[model samples]
Target chain A: MSRTRVQHFSISLDGFGTGEGLSRQAPFGHAGERLHAWMFATRFGKTMFGQQGGTSGVDDAILSTFAVGIGAEIMGSNKFGYPGWHENKDWTGWWGANPPFHTPVFVMTQHKRAPLELEGGTVFHFTDAPPADVLAMAREAAGGRDVRIGGGVRILRAFLKERLIDHMHLVQVPILLGRGVRLWDGLEGLEQVFDIETTASSSGVTHLMFARKGG
Target chain B: MSRTRVQHFSISLDGFGTGEGLSRQAPFGHAGERLHAWMFATRFGKTMFGQQGGTSGVDDAILSTFAVGIGAEIMGSNKFGYPGWHENKDWTGWWGANPPFHTPVFVMTQHKRAPLELEGGTVFHFTDAPPADVLAMAREAAGGRDVRIGGGVRILRAFLKERLIDHMHLVQVPILLGRGVRLWDGLEGLEQVFDIETTASSSGVTHLMFARKGG
Candidate 1:
């Protein structure tokens, strides 16, 4: 009964998961922190970053479930670091020494690197294998628990195209990012496979949850 | 203080306003009545089509605003009829004898045609003009009342690009039309000009309302 899930993924009104021109200095490019402002304002988000004083409403309620019942994570290389992260061997990640994901983290990339064991019980494993192969590895590492598919849009779309996602939660921010990596491009008619539900938060973001039917 | 507004314009979760392959046989193309099913379930929608016994909740409350406020309407030729409608001289419109729009409905198209006045005070005027010029005509016909910018996606986006819309209400339906005319194309950073708000109905549709900041 181990399921693959995606939680708290934010997208712009135009369906862009992240803005264009991502770099080391600007991890989200022109998007900055706009796409994640809602999460940052949540109590769960504040606590995750070792901060204090944040709202504990519906936004927080959803953000709190991000790490629940999920062992291990499969993230795209872009989510691991900026573009061309392979060139820099010293690039630990956007998160400092103490990372959030305490489980085994699998970073999907074409370039291979030795496994990195960071502080706070987080271990980074680099691989160039396809989605199904990577999922299989992550599922085994999950130890009979659900596997979380951490995304940077491309990898999420790939797993979704293969119908590997059991439960997906997408937070639709109201801002219109005219150009960027769109999340809904090729995944047309997705409602046919998933029973989608939407909840609008007071902070001007819509939470869309898609659960695979008969999964 | 008359303004131009769009209300109860339904689109898929993927931002598609209308599906592909629109013809006389299928008005909404592959989408059929799926996109507007939420509206049709509303009491206001049932009354519009001369039916009865429908829900009168938030969906009805929103759908009722489609015909509220002042005067004339501006719609794309595609909204008026199928493609190549100019070739058919007898093609009055998809709406039978008495169309829903009782005001002067201006149809924007490159091929000009004579004004076709139908029953119930619905006069169809064809003109090939820019957004401002067409707005001028519609405004004049509106007679100091607010003008409603009816859309088929393209015209709505054109008016939005020109920053002429004072208020816009878009209903995000749960269905996903894989292929269709998108409503949010080329409309980057639209949140800068408008104050946006969202409300999710129990019927699984989200209503997004945008009002011009200063207007």
Candidate 2:
């Protein structure tokens, strides 16, 4: 029974997951990592960048669960690379030679490509299939463990709309990204199916955890 | 030196202050009392209804400040009365003989009407003045005390767009209204002028407090 989960997803106060004007140079566009600055200040976020001395508070505790009991990851094309990265066959990913995901990573895109095996047991599986097909593939690849939805907002919203997500954690940063890719659009009355719990940290970000009811 | 403040204003997680289809029967429309239900569970809200025994924790402590240091109040027409309420001349307001507000209340509306004085010190004065003019009038009526911006979202958004609000405290309810009057629209980059603080109560509502810098 592998659960589908979305972890450590950050959004602005105005519900934007990533800012507008995204490019190769500015991955998050004008957002400039502000949405995830809180996580960066946490112990887990610091360890990701090979840094030290971060807070071990609520943020750190929750963010540390990113790698817990997970086997495979499914990410959107936007998160895999910038606009038109599929055209350039050389584009492996934003992550260097050895990516953090030490498992089979499925990139949901219309353009299919050969599975590129990277260091640290990470393999990129590009697929043109829909969510259910991708989920099934990811689940099989995950063995008996859970599958993570590594998103850039659009993919997360699509999964949420289809009721494919089991557990979701959204970190709400306290900044107004006036223009960006919104997360809450079209997913109205989401509380009907999920139980939402809100917790605020001293570092100024609010964690909204949503668990599917009776799942 | 009276400061313009907005206190205890509740909005849904999706940013809707009030739901659609407003009428005399359902003041908040589809939203009903869900947004203010947390406040009602507080000691201050219980005391308002002449009841006793309610939570006096963070929610109560913060809600108890709704009337602190306020002289006069300014609100939108939507908050004053339901749509087409002006057609019925006898209609005073949603609140009965003795309204909650005990200050000289200024109702911003296009329709001009004579002053309607209710029980206690609450007097309804209808005016079509803009945000600045209404603030000046409310300030004058407030004397040396602070003036509160009692909103239904539209008026508050107007005042916020004009940057006339000195302090604002918004309670974000967990429920998603889906559709209604939104609070955050057109007022982008608001954080540049106001410093925001967030606190979550045990009753499952997040309080967002914004104070203008150097005001």
Go through the candidates in order and give each one's DockQ.
0.85, 0.70
Q: Which window of ten consecutive residues has the lowest lDDT sum in model 1 chain B? A: B61-70
Model 2 TM-score on a 0 to 1 scale: 0.97
Model 2, residue B165: distance off in Å is 1.2
User: Model 1, B149: alpha-carbon shift in Å?
Assistant: 0.7
Best by TM-score: 1
lDDT of model number 2: 0.91
- Model 2: colliding residue pairs: none
Candidate 1 Cα misplacement greater than 4 A, ranges: none
lDDT of 2 by residue, B157-188 (tens): 99999999999999999887878888877766
